[model samples]
Target: MITLTGRLICADAAQAALVQLYLPDHIRLTRAEPGCLSFDVVPTSDPLVWQVNETFTDRAAFDAHQTRTRESRWFKETAHIRREFRIIG
Candidate 1:
């Protein structure tokens, strides 16, 4: 299995709001993906910062998820996010 953890910080409220706006679709689509063991994207007290936690059945699944995500509108929209993330077994 692979677990992905991260913090996503937007530039400001407007950017964060953009994330908030599309969050439902993002979460729903991601969770519905194949081999998605778990997926959560939640807001923090600091509105600009959002927490991310995801798990996949394997590296291949995770890689597939990455590819799909890159092609998503959320990816194009949040291209300016400051991300701090890591993957673990």
Candidate 2:
């Protein structure tokens, strides 16, 4: 299994709004994907930050997630927003 942690920082109000609007679709797609063991989005106490946790069955699943997320319009729309991600075993 693999775990992914994502931290998103939205500095602009418009960017934040776009992130909020895109979140539901992101969650839905992640959860529905095959080999997805778990997916969660946690709002930080600071409104500008968001924490995402995801687990997948294996490397192939993780790669699939990458493909899907990269293809998503929401991801493209939010590309300008500051974000960081980490992967752990």
Candidate 3:
């Protein structure tokens, strides 16, 4: 299994609006994918930061997620967003 943990940071007040607008779609699409074990978006104490916690069955599943996000218009539009990820043991 592979876990993808990350925090997404948006500029100023745009975080909440972006989360409300785009997170649901990301959740629905990612969770529905074949190898997705879980996909969740959580709020952070800082208004401009949000966390993304995702698990996939394997590396292939992770790759698929990368492809989907890269091709997504929503992600492209939010290109200014900053993110960081860590691998879990």
Name the best candidate (by TM-score): 1
Ranking according to TM-score, highest score first: 1, 2, 3
* Ordered list by lDDT, greatest first: 1, 2, 3
Worst 10 residues of 1 by lDDT: 74-83
1-89: candidate 1 lDDT, tens digit per residue: 99999999998889988899887898899899999999999888997999999999999999999999999998898877888899998
Tell me the spans in candidate 2 whose CA falls farther than 4 Å from its real position: none
What residue pairs are clashing in model 3? Answer: none
lDDT of 3 at 55: 91
True-vs-predicted CA distance for residue 35, candidate 1, Å: 0.4
For model 2 the local lDDT of residue 42 reads 80
Candidate 1 clash total? 0
What number of backbone clashes does candidate 3 have, counting pairs of residues 3 or more apart or in separate chains?
Answer: 0
Write one digit per residue (lDDT tens) for candidate 2, span 1-89.
99989999999678889989999999999999999999998889888889989999999999999899999987898989888989987
Q: Give the alpha-carbon lDDT of every model.
A: 0.91, 0.91, 0.82
Q: Which regions of candidate 1 fall more than 4 Å away from where they truly are? A: none
Model 3 residue runs over 4 Å out of place are none
